[model samples]
Target: MTANRRPVIVGVDGSPAGLGAVRWAADEAVRHGKPLRITHALGVPGPFEQPFEQVVDEHDIALDAATEARGWYPGLHITTSTWHGSPAHVLVEESRHASLVVVGSRRTGGFRSLLVGSVGLQLAARAYCPVLIVHNAERWAAPESPLPRQPIVVGFDGSAHSDFAVGLAFSEAATRGVELVAVRAWREQARRWGRGADLTRLAAAVRDALAADLEPWQAKYPTVPVGLRAVRGTAAPVLLAEGSDALMVVLGPRGRGGLDDVRLGSVTQQVLDHASIPVLIAQHA
Candidate 1:
């Protein structure tokens, strides 16, 4: 991303969630001194019998909303576009070279207020740069008041997807100039608890591997402060604690679990459900 040209991209469709995203994104562009590129993704229900412009009525409204919100950031460089495709696809593809991507959370069903939507999951899974899944509008509008507190942190397991998440976290820390933390969650069932000696060796191995994975990043961004820890707990609690006061959390979408959810990385999903801050997931590429 060029220092003078790269813009912050946002996805919108005029939902309350989308409005929250626009409002948050406007501030982000100003904070970073980056242009805001607002995009609206639309779709056609049937055959393409009419012009592309006729189907995406939502984009017009989104454009209007973005225009009106620009008042909050009078100096921000803003642009708008309308695309026709999956929200995840359109937004993620557009963010390929973006400094950062921001989007709002979808409402959870009934009382499932903490739930995340399939599109948010898909974007987080696929986006290469930092993606902030804005869930709480009231909180984010005043982001600078008190944020970027590191807690409930998580670390990658060295797969490509996890590496992408690492890069995401690294960029976030670099941007904020805060400590980028790394965590490896551990769980030992009764079957393995008996071998106390073996446990010691296993713990050592996890430690060694984590150091190796973080080496390249540490060296590349030497000035970016870092903290490394291997926790003996489940993914949810560890992540929640690590991500506390976190501006954004990063995770990966692994596979389907016993339940019917399309995205099976429940740890990340659960974090999204409960956390007040933003969550970004990197799915298998």
Candidate 2:
């Protein structure tokens, strides 16, 4: 399929979190003018034969999610499917044909509430398309409701992947008619030696680098109000603090020091684990 025709895919597991993901996916499909694909993974069978009834139940999960989405977005085009594999694997395969994949950050218990599920983490690391992990789904407004005038926060460190992230963030901000906050974090060894002047110079250089990186995107998206933040700290903490009330946090799958062997970067993983708002992991097709 063409890129514009690629569907917005969402995985459902019959849980409240899964249903919430369906709602978010529906709204996104409408916004992008793409079809919505609601799917359920039946999971890999064990040593013993899987029950036929379990397959039927899984099919029902996908159908129910489609029904819920249709009710909320009556005009949106949607499709439903069921696959026999792990949720992460199935969604990763589906991502090959999708524009975006969305799932909920299902909180199972106390500590888990602060982290995304195994499937979400896996998709963030491996999906071919961007993966969106929706958090605090209960507060997500209706499709026609106006979004808060919060900015879309994006982390950029001049890596090729982060450059793509900056572009995506600008598109999202423009689409929502909101501001775009581009944050670049740096570590200053001078601070440890109490060298105030050196630290000031370092901060200035970093800010100039960030501005240069953002120059082209700002020109391309002239209407998107851009805010630049050059902070002296680690990426994850700075992003989480700045995006506390953001519409969503956009990030690359990896960063400047990311190894080719590593599918996900440490900073992205840290933010995904703790972000209370939606997190979008940008991927190159």
Candidate 3:
């Protein structure tokens, strides 16, 4: 295992979803050639004190998770830690020094009740670095495995936040030696649209803007093949549908202006809540 500045941090518990996160994180760590840090957050036990054996059991579960990931990536550097704090807070703090933070889609509850767990949501909203939420089940059939040419789908709307997302997506695609799919969704403004108005010009403009936004990135990552798509209608649904065959979906939180509820944009939230593949939320520096 080689020492590196930024390690891949993952929140791990004994649950199946947690182990899936560990596996996904390990794969990413290998891709990035960075160390893997597996973390377990132990919340305070209730008034009824837990037996000594139970305490040991909890630690063992975390240890086992780390061991599994280490075994899978023999040459990868791996470390494990248990912190006494809430899972979201602990993982968020860990993200400060990590290149990326990974978490399970669901934890400790009936799966049908929620599409994503609360902890995963909190971390995605607050983590300093990129946050990846890995779903346990594969919801789409990929035309090929996530190698050689898997596409990294990014949502772009020409905003600064979207710019950040595009940059990250380009880097990830370049790193994996894969293609980058930049999608921009547009719709005619009802106020500007008249009956039987021609939308051809509007569609062309949207497509051109998307290409312009991607031009610099294309130059920066010459080896990465990029495909720009200007789709009609809402951004969320378009990106979600594209997630069907993507290795991962990269998106930025909605821009912060004009509205108090813009901390995490609704479109980004929708994709995070429903993306079948791992979703990486690119945070603003």
Candidate 4:
């Protein structure tokens, strides 16, 4: 399928948080003019095979999610499906054809749950498309209410992954008509630099680097009011603080400092665990 036509996929598990993801996915679909797909994964059955009742329950969960999403967008082009596999594996496969995959921050059960245990991490690290984890899905209950007019915050450190993240962040901010805040975090070596003039030069250098990285995106999205912040601290903490009131926090799967063998970066993992708002892991297109 064409990139613009790829559907926005949401995994549901009959939980309040899952339903919230439906709402967010529906809005995203409308915002970007894409179809919405509501899915449920019924983990691989035992040797005895799956029971009829269990299959029926899973089907109902998918349908219920679709119904709720339709209520929010009556004209939405949407579909529902059920798969037999681990939640992470099923969604990762689906992500191959999806524009974005969304899930709730919490789940109630094991079979169909998306965020329980290592499922969320797996999807973040392995999905072919971007993965969005919606925190506090209950807050999205009302479809007519406007999202907060807060800025969208993104972190970049000149990695290929972060470059994709910055592009996605600019697109999101442009769509929402909000400011885009691009942040870069750095650490100073106390042994090499003194407190006065050295620290001042370091801050300026960091700012210049950030601005250079953002120049192309700024030209592409001229209307998106941009803010550059170069802070001296850890990536995770700086991002968490900068995005405390943001509409959402956007990050790469891994940063420049991330080891080549690691699937998910430590900073990305830390932000996912502590951020109160939605977090999106940008996928390389």
TM-score against truth, every candidate: 0.70, 0.89, 0.86, 0.92
Candidate 4 regions exceeding 4 Å error are: 45-54, 107-112, 142-146, 192-197
Q: Is candidate 2 or 4 superior in TM-score?
A: 4
- Compared to the true structure, candidate 1 yields what TM-score? 0.70
Better of 1 and 4 by TM-score: 4
Task: After superposing candidate 1 on the true structure, give the runs of residues whose Cα lies further than 4 Å from its correct spot.
Answer: 1-6, 23-34, 42-60, 83-100, 109-116, 125-130, 142-154, 188-205, 255-266, 283-285
Put down candidate 2 lDDT per residue, 183-217, tens digits, no spaces.
Answer: 99999654555435576788889989999989999
Model 1, CA-based lDDT = 0.67
Better candidate by TM-score, 2 or 3: 2
Kindly state the number of residue pairs that clash in model 4.
0
Q: Each candidate: what lDDT?
A: 0.67, 0.84, 0.76, 0.87
What tens-digit string does per-residue lDDT give for candidate 3 at 1-285?
233558998887666677777777788899888888888877652342678787677678678887777767689888888766678888888888888888877534653222247877888788888888887522211213232246999998888887888888998898788889999888877665557546888888898988987888888888989888888888889999987799889988674231544557888888877777788888743
lDDT of 3 at 217: 85
Task: Sort by lDDT, best first.
Answer: 4, 2, 3, 1
lDDT of 3 at 285: 39
RMSD of each: 5.4, 3.3, 4.1, 2.2
| Model 1, backbone clash pairs (residues 3+ apart or across chains), number | 16
On lDDT, who's better, 1 or 3? 3
Clashing pairs in 3: none
The candidate that wins on lDDT is 4
In angstroms, the error of model 4 at 34 is 1.0
